[model samples]
Target: MKFSRFAILYVSFSLAVALLALGLQHFLETVPVLSPHFWLLFAVIFLLTGLAYGLSDIGIRKGGQVSILSLMGGLFLKLLISLVVIAVLIIKFPENKLLTAINFFSLYFLFTLFEVICLLRNLRDQNQT
Candidate 1:
């Protein structure tokens, strides 16, 4: 199935903001860490990442899957999107920028890991017909 225009817009907007976030991370080195720009850029990254996940969810809805795939796809796809965003940041300007990305990845990894385990635990494969 084809995606709606809003879905396309979400993908575009997320990529643009994610790209801008890499530049903003570099600029943060010279400005006050708590400056409006820092928080503003951070918020943009957060929103864009969320929109990317929303796009993923939309795609999943348009398709079909059962069992493991449905449970794993959401986590994996979001991680994939987040990783790409971070990778682009490092590739465009490689350095300790990886420091920030590393911390974020660790936190996200643990949280999503917890979520996936909890979701899987809720299902009983042996009893299902």
Candidate 2:
């Protein structure tokens, strides 16, 4: 997929997720289901996913094994950065460690799924050509 197309789709998806998160947090205001730093987590995950997608797309355009390597590398870097963020959050906010971790992973998986689907579509298009 083109970078422009990916950016549009990704921004849309991020906005939808943000809206859903806002609704969920509002509905569960009394409960501590969501972390206090929800927006920070959202921004971090969003930027990481976009960066990874861009890296993978560039790799795909270059062809051959570079594509797979770049995809894997991007994912690995995302994971590492996410882990560091989680660790810092847990240390700084010990009261809501579990909630923060859960929310972080939830967003991580959701974005990863979207990234995979888009990449697969791109690969298919490349193969067809």
Candidate 3:
């Protein structure tokens, strides 16, 4: 879980997701399943996840209870920011609220799961050392 390693892995994951989303959008061109602002959502989630990971990684290096607190704090901040972004998007563009929310949440969950998995692996490694 070095920051560099995490950055590489996260960027790769984000790119993969972006490609999948683009493909899906292309496939469903006639339908409006995904919002036009899908790329915006992707960028927001990607930056948030990276920022959270960096903060948590720094805390992990410091050790002790700080690590746990940092991880929790990062998760909370990410969730809060994501909610705000989604709410604004929904309110501002009320045309495809449901579809946009669904797409946004799916990306959010996927990114969150990836971060959690990486963080857990980092914690396990820290314990082993």
> Lowest-lDDT window of 10 residues in candidate 1?
32-41
The TM-score obtained by model 2 is: 0.96
Tens digits of per-residue lDDT, candidate 3, 12-99, equal 9998998898888789989876787888998999999988988888888899999989999999999999999999999999988988
Give a tens-digit lDDT track for model 2, residues 1-129. Answer: 899999999999999999998888789988876788778988998999999999999999999999999989989998899889989989988987888989999999999999999999999999999
Please provide, for model 1 over 17-124, each residue's C-alpha lDDT reduced to its tens digit, 9 standing for 90 to 100: 456656765788775323223333345445544544444444444445554465456566666766676666667656556465654564455445444443433343
Any idea what lDDT model 3 has?
A: 0.91
Steric collisions counted per model: 0, 0, 0
Which regions of candidate 3 deviate over 4 angstroms? none
The TM-scores of all predictions, comma-separated, are 0.43, 0.96, 0.96
Instruction: List candidate 2 segments past 4 Å from native.
Output: none
lDDT of each: 0.50, 0.91, 0.91
